[model samples]
Target: MLDIKQIREATDFVRERLASRGGGEESLVDEVLELDERRRRLLAEVEALKAERNRVSKEIGRLLAEGKREEAEARKRETRSLGDRIAELDRQVGEVEAAREALMLRMPNLPHESVPVGRSAEENVVVRVFGEPARHAFGPKTHVELCERLGLVDFARAAKVSGSGFALYTGRGARLERALIQFMLDLHTREHGYTEVWPPLMVGPACLEGVGQFPKFKDQYYGVAEGDDPSNLGRLYLIPTAETVVANLHREEILREGDLPIRYCAYTPCFRGEAGAAGVGTRGLIRMHQFDKVELIQVVRPEDGYEAHEAMVRHAERVLQLLGLHYRVVLLCTGDLGFASAKTYDLEVWAPGQGTYLEVSSVSNCEEFQARRMRLRYKDCQGVNRHPHVLNGSGTALARLYVALVETYQQADGSVLIPEAVRPYFGEERITP
Candidate 1:
């Protein structure tokens, strides 16, 4: 959630940045300001009424002590009316506050000033490219074709068992998935300075809200609603990413100034309701309702956020680098930035068979947007509590990374050669037909 005070103080600035997001978001700031004014006005009225009631009660007491019974009764009646007025104003204040909060929750974070102003992915700027897309003497086979010929993933049965947008890996495929997860987790924790955490896959609504996933993107998640379900967590939602859980580890917390930067890496089976674009090139591991991902999270001092963002981009890029995959880092413009992120960088790996660059990870700097929602604060050197900047990235999402790996390494013999970096973890050099 954005700081209301920021909007109140910098209305035009916030509106202009939000306008760059291209959603008529300037109007949202106006609404928030209007509601804020009403809420404050109501609160002021309630305070005045309360004060008047107190003064009247004191006068009533004095009148009774002076034996002016009639005067005391009149003042006592005035106090009653003042109390009733205060109650009504208090109720109005609560309603207005709720309306303001709802709007705040729905508002996207203001785009960082440095972000390029654009309208979509087409306008995203490619910051750097690593290696070139390969050419195959024999026509390249898609990951789907590769998986089928090699008997790796059982997509047909995944549909039978759980319907579409799901996959069940067998033998080498399952092993490969596990190896990728372990590889990324180890890389992030052992080298990237991130602490490993295993958070609950199912989380409460507040957890989703704290991470800016609720109210707006609720349709993209799986959940158990409130009722007599007999579940320990009556109302719960399965996390869409480990970021959703790991970032909340310090939710509603106040940290020491020395612990300015907190890094965490977690591996989780993320469940989603929305599959990606439909039809061609969307088959196989390119899009799945349930997929494995190793997520990276960092909370740092406000000033260090951009530095952390750059380092996070490097960390994610290293994974693809070690795997020897050809990929590019694209800096997202304001229009393409995630809801909670002030800025983001997407890593797209070239899938020769798929004949496209598949996004394998998105490293985002959310600034203090999420910390404000989570009420996560850290005491500064001045002993002032302030929201710390938060960052999250897919150390890499596995499905498409899996697709890129197989499609890029497929041999004419209908087998997939495991990348050398993952060879030891996969326990084999190739998945032979």
Candidate 2:
């Protein structure tokens, strides 16, 4: 939520920003300001009325003590009417304040001044490209084709069990997925200074709200089935991302100043409904109902979050770089960015068989958006408490990373060369039947 006072003070600045985000009424800003003014004025009026009532009550007390019944009676009657008026105004003030807050929450965070002004992902500027897309002398096999031929992935059985878009990674395929998870967790925890934390795979609605996912993306997430209830309305849902849980670890609590920058990493199987998605793009592990991912989350001082966000992007990119996969870094445009993120950097890996760049990671700097909702704060040296900035990035998404690995490294003989970083865990260089 925005500070109403700042919204009032920076109306023009806010207007320009809302315009850049696309169509929205500029009057919405005016509305917030107008309601804010009314709310503040009513508050002051109520305070004044309360003060008058207090003064009158004291005067009445004095009158009664002196046995001046008539004066005391008059003062008491006057305050009775004032009390009724205060109650009426108080009701109005509450209603107006509630409306103002609803509007404030609907408002998007103002884009950073340095952010590029663009409409869609097509307009996103590539900051850098790393490694070259590998080439196959013969027709390259897609991960699905390669996985099927090698008896590695079992989509036919997965479909019978769950439906399309889900795959059963058997033997080496499963081991490869586990290996990648271990590799990422090890790198992030040992070398990159992140603490390993295993958070709940199932979390409540409040946790989703902390990451600004509930109200906007309720459709995209999977809610837990309510037992014996006709409507599947329940208190909890399968977590869509570790971000939902890890970011809210300190929700509603104040952290010690010494723990200013907290880093946490977790491996969890994420579940998503993907309600309206379809077609070739949504096939295989690229989009799934359930997939495993190693998530990296950080809570940092406001001054350090942007730098931390950059480091997070590099960390995600390093995973692909180590795997010898070509990828590019994209700075998301306003439309392409997530709801809570003020800025987002996406890592798209080259999928040779698919002949496209598949987004394998998104590192976002949410600033204080999630913190405000979670009430996660830290006290500074001056004894001032403020929301700590939060950031989360996929250390790597194992499923899609597996897609890139299978497709890019597949040989004409139908074997996959495991990356050196994951080989120690997988126990071999070649995944052959």
Scored against the true structure, residue 9 in model 1 reaches a CA lDDT of 93
TM-scores for all predictions: 0.95, 0.94
lDDT string for model 2 (1-433, tens) is 4556667788898788766766473558988988999999999999999999999999999999999999999999999999999999999999998998767666766666656888888888899999999989999988888888888889889988888767898987888888999999999998899999998888889898778887767898877876777576647899988899999899999987788799999999998887787752355777888888889999999999899999999888889988999999999877667778788989999999889998989999988888887888998888889888899999899688888999989987878998898899889999875
lDDT of 2 at 72: 98
Q: What is the lDDT of residue 268 in candidate 1?
A: 95
Badly placed stretches (over 4 Å) of model 2 are: 23-27, 230-232, 278-282
Among these predictions, the greatest TM-score belongs to: 1
Error of 2 at 251 (Å): 1.6
How much is 422 displaced in model 1, in angstroms? 1.0
